[model samples]
Target: MSPDLSLIFVLGLRMAVAAAFVVSASIIAERSGPVIGALVATLPISAGPSYVFLALDHDAAFIAEGALASLPVNAATLFLALTYVLLAQRHGLLLSLVSALAVWFLLAAGLRALDLSLVGGLIANVVAFAICVPLMQRYGHVKMPLITRRWYDIPFRASLVAVLVAAVVTLSGRVGPAITGILALFPVVFTSLMLILHPRIGGPATAAVIANGGWGLMGFGVAIAVLHVAALRFGSAVGLSLALATCVGWNLALWWNGRRKVAVAK
Candidate 1:
């Protein structure tokens, strides 16, 4: 498979734009409140475009096709971030870690049975999710105001929107770029609106962190999409390289931020 330079360039540009929107929106949502930020973060906005990409490539097996085509890694990462917030609101670090690990292993084994070697991706996501749980719990103690009463309705509404939109987009056909762009931009738009509407909430640091994290997640997703395109054009190895690069870049950003916080505290 020869590389399509044109497609690569287009995908890269699309990803950059989408990532910028995610970051901006997340910042706005976080500033509005934890409940709202978590709600927006967990909506799986990246899934629609991802599925559209898979359909474009004509991948038959849903799991493989979807996993490769869409930004599962990115969606899973944000979902994990929101999960950490939810856990911190109700549980301690040890319990949250245990639960996250349990979920990861269970999902990994189940996916493996289906012959998906992408178990590593799932594990990586679980680890990312777990990292935030402890941090949020600790932060909750110092930043009491950050822990808003969980708005159960927000998750329900967000989930409903995510599912409905994803379904509609997936069934719509080869509009991969357009579908993904819309899905990728949804959270940004929602979060930004919320932030503007409710300016007196959450605070600057929380908003920044959430926004940055969202950008990182979106970047991660776009990276996945690039990998899928690469694999289709080149080979599995090339795709794997792109996937690993995304994971490494995201994790590195996480580590860098964590270290910076530690340094500031000292």
Candidate 2:
């Protein structure tokens, strides 16, 4: 796709939406409770920039490179953000800005030495880290009141689901852009559900389903996006649509569940 004004406009809009979601989630978290908000914020914080990159480019190599390059910065930002939040009690705006710039400088130097294009990498690095700081502080930590046992299993469970989806898609010979797109939905759905349900899976159930599910979903989404794009297919649009659906579905389910529980308790 040519870099045109319309494309730039769309990219801007996507960034805006992502920014808005992150901010809203963070605010909601700060209001509801600090720990929960921090944990909740991680979703948009970590995934938002990557999502933007995927939306902008359908190239597998490019996506992989971008993801790989961005991971360190993302991790650093999350850790720092969490630290700042714990220490500051409120959002650490100045610290976040400085940390972001520091990360960008380090990433830029590394990219330069490796002879990689810094254009997209710089943007991704800056934006991803900048957003992750507040998010980590607001909703990065997992504190599941209702699902305490399964709280720790969220990431693992999501990853497993994502892997299973990728495996099935691969074996079915239906691993095209469309199929990959469908597969990408699994993570989005899985994460959304986990965030909403925050269920408690005690005993072995915790290890088997809960942990694997979280990692599975994330892994599957990233894997399929990479593989599909590598095959020269553009599945991002479909994948994005599925992600939106997952988010919507998750919120609805949560609302319904909350109401039902309240009614039962009363």
Candidate 3:
């Protein structure tokens, strides 16, 4: 293969493979119901694949800086989820998603104006979630109805994620670490959920999934914080493992507890 053709082939392969991974995770999320769905949604479906590609190109320190910037962006996503969950209860899909995206963009844009250190990012997340967690508990659960699957659903969603990931990979270099980090954590899964579910099952049902996702979102913040520390200490490879472990372990514990409660109720 010629060098240029090989580069094109590699890029195409990256897009296809990442898209497949995100689409598969999203399907599992839809099938899993609110609690587990949130768990699955909160996993690093898009971000994880993007990180793998980034790690291939960047050093450990670079990866660590990206993780540092991702901290507050994770909080912004939780706010986006909260905004969508609330608006979806009383609004159409357009209003709900547009409002949520607005919230996300505002937070991301604000990050550019501030000199946000690691501590500042952590504090921002803590304060935001402190207010939202209680609301999530009250409003996040609703009985989910069966979804009618469309032939285009998976393909459509796969394309969106692929495009988003490609943009992140292509742009991460030109953008500084703060912006790159924020872009990496974009809520592609949440956007897909609203697109697929709101029309099929209605707003309240779709909103429940976002609301339920709050805990996992918080866990994601913690995991990224750990990634920042671990990368600086142990290296990016080890940091990624530990960060993934933290998120996975947190969700697993929540899942086990949910099951234990159901068994007791039975």
Q: Write the per-residue lDDT of candidate 3 for residues 95-203, one digit (tens) a residue.
A: 9999999999998778646857888888988988997777777776688888879999999999989888788778878996767787889899999999999999999
Q: Which stretches of candidate 3 lie over 4 Å from their true place?
A: none
Per-residue lDDT of candidate 1, residues 105-157 (tens digit): 34433433343234444445456555554444433322214434245434433
> TM-scores, in order shown?
0.37, 0.37, 0.96
Q: List the residue pairs that clash in candidate 3.
A: none
Please report, as a residue range, the 10-residue window in candidate 1 with the lowest summed lDDT: 193-202
Task: Give the range of the ten consecutive residues with the poorest summed lDDT in model 2.
Answer: 201-210
Query: How many pairs collide in each candidate, listed in order?
Result: 2, 28, 0
Better of 1 and 3 by lDDT: 3
Relative to the true structure, candidate 2 reaches a TM of 0.37
TM-score, candidate number 3:
0.96
